[model samples]
Target: MVRAFKNTLIIFSSLLFCFAQQEDSLKVGLQSLKKIESDVIIISAEVRSGNLNPTAYRFSVFPRHRPSEVYISRMFFPGDSLQVVLPENILDADSLANIASLEPVGGSFEKSYKLFSKQSDVIDLGIFDVKKKSDIVKLSVVDGQTGSPVLKPTIKIFQLGKVLYQTVLDSSGYGRLRIPIDRNREIPLYALIDTDGRYPLWRGSIEVSQGVSSITLALNSMSLMIGESLFRVRSDLTPFRKGPENGSEILFMLSKDDHIVISRSAGNKLYGRVRLDLHTKKSSNFFHGWIRTKDVEYLETFATDTNHD
Candidate 1:
């Protein structure tokens, strides 16, 4: 009887030891899993647009190095927060931050935000406001000299040197755009009209009022004297010199899409004038210099009967 009791006690002790070892192993495994999870980061943000259908928009995250490998979230409502998971080491040394974009379906009106570094594993971006399509204003483009509508014009609206909206006008030269309004009830925006090389590029700034419904853009005609002709600067940062010689001093630089009125040509050089601001009426804004004929492309000639003596 004494031998049997000792055997049973030993067996119980061994079983207890086995159970303790298994518990320790499980604890170590769980710790390793948690350590791996800590190497990742979570980004969250709430997007809202007043009275707009939130289902029409989606969120996306573009990794800095691998832009093609994007992370997208499911459709979220107005009040719901968007979440994205990324590895902590996703940012490289050359990149400052990753880019997150909120885009609507079937449209190019996208808003982007930068994802910066955070010490915490979770980063929360505050509410992001999206502009609604209902905040629109009608636009009418017409010729300043002729008072005729510019048919089927390509229009681009800019704010702070960034393109906010772009669309082509209909046959009536009319289009509508959603203008973002600020707290001041007025926003200064620029409009660029392209008539398919029919006229010089028209750029002008206008003050948009929140209460205004429609605005008209008056584009100046490309007018030149009898001896003058129109040429477009073909290259960016082309040098405009003081004289026709290659050793002449560079008076200024002209960029691509800038129009020049050429009066005469000497050897490989052309004397031309560039209007600094076509919308402005100041005569001092006209800068005349010599540009190489290789840098400009002839658009049209403006010879009239008045050139006859």
Candidate 2:
């Protein structure tokens, strides 16, 4: 009996020691995790407006031409606050203060407006509303180069930063929309057209009265100087230059999948053009600049090309 009691005590002592070692290791692991987490920092931001609760709005932050963007979540309310923790050097390396509220007023527009962040961590976003209706406007959309009817062209009707209506044109390249205007008062309205969101085709404005009006719009091509060779960006984040040489000024950045049609070549740089629809996918602006030959991978060689293994 004495020997059995001694063996049982030894087994119990060994278990206690093992348990103590495991508890100490677990505590060390938790301490290491806490130290690593301390390095992460989060910034609190708020979106405010006088008329509407800006908390309902979704925000996207990005550069002028880059596709990648930081989406601010909608977890904040009552105070219209949000938490932002950008990647390292993203603020200094690229622009992030530009805020575009992805909220569509009356369910139409989705353009990014510039919002400067202040030291108080607040972003002031203004609100807009549609005005009264007074005019029946008719327009035809056609290809600028070929005069061909652009089928299914998207037309966005906007006034004072607020989108009133969005419609796709009929097969005849024609569409009509009512503009909100008061009689004897000339209110300005804008229209943006695109072909299936692939490219921004045209952007124009109109002055409306209490009467019917008609106009014809010519759609711009995504490619510059058609009948030339076309090429796609070889890599993402390729910079468009102002001249053909190295150290040339960067005009803008292009995505790798975006297509470009070469207009001409000077020295080692190729002059090209592109039309961007921006974030709204409505209004499009034109850009013409130089690109280095080495920066682009050829989709097709020129007609004067010679074979070289």
Candidate 3:
């Protein structure tokens, strides 16, 4: 009985020893993982619009050496200042050259960053602005038919399928875009006007170079050619101006129910021929003039069945 007791105690000691060894091994493994698995880095992202908040945001870090191993980060907000642990392989000396950030705004945006070259761990992605004089691209918008300035049209510039700059035309019908100087000219810089589909889309491209270069975009006429008629929906009498703006000379007056046919556009104004009476079965006399878009409503009829009524 004494020998049997001694044997049982020996087995218990052996089991305890095994458990202790496993516990030590686990501790060592965790320490190694914490030390060598990821590199701690800080990133600060700012929105393009200084005062506006971003919708949803995520940033992606891509290593030049291992293109397949893209590390997409967690949710980020505008003006976010946070630390993130990226894969340690990105620290490899060979991998340091071509790291970049994909879509810092969480939408269709592509910006590159050299992760390894950053002496400090912090990366600040501030508002997109023209950092260098060589990066500025001057753009002008005008009417395709009349050669007048086209105002308030949205412009988007893209390079290699990535958006570089986007803004709306100012009162002067001009927008300044910041783009990297393309030395090779292999990638054509493209621009699109009226991206919202409210008007006919106008596209243009240029072989980009260093320093300021100007491009003129002409928008097609918005005027009704013939037989097309649009109803005026303004509740009160609207003035028809000799020019596009409200301060221009008033050519005539139109009622809410007048039938008008557009002929051309000046800035946001539509130049059209309008009938004096919308309810008249007989042909009515029509007048020609410009009307502001804000004062009237027009139907967007892409495809209509003439016999449906």
TM-score of decoy 3? 0.35
Distance (Å) between predicted and true CA of 179, model 1?
1.6
Which runs in model 3 stand beyond 4 Å of their true positions?
A: 36-44, 51-54, 64-69, 73-75, 79-83, 91-96, 102-309
How far off is residue 15 in model 3, in Å?
2.6
> Where is the poorest 10-residue window by lDDT in model 2?
103-112
lDDT string, candidate 1, 1-309, tens digits: 999999999999999999999999999999998887988888787766654554555777666667677755555555565787777766443534465667655433445565644434886776667654334779998877688988999988787778777899998889887765532344577888888666667777765655448888776555677788788888789999998889999988887767888889999899978876533522226788999998988875433412322
Per-residue CA lDDT of candidate 2, range 124-213, in tens? 444422123346778788776688888888888777778867888899898887664433244567877767434333556755544788
- The TM-scores of all predictions, comma-separated, are 0.50, 0.38, 0.35
lDDT at 188, model 1: 70
Worst 10 residues of 1 by lDDT: 300-309
Summed over model 3, clashes come to: 6
CA lDDT of every candidate? 0.72, 0.60, 0.59
Give the per-residue lDDT of model 3 (tens digit) for 1-309: 999999999999999999999999999999988876445555454445443234545555555777677665566665564335654444444534435453445333334343544434565644442122236667788765578787778878787778777888887788787675533356677777772323345555755556677767666523454444453536456788787777999977665534455656778888877544233212235677888777766655521213211
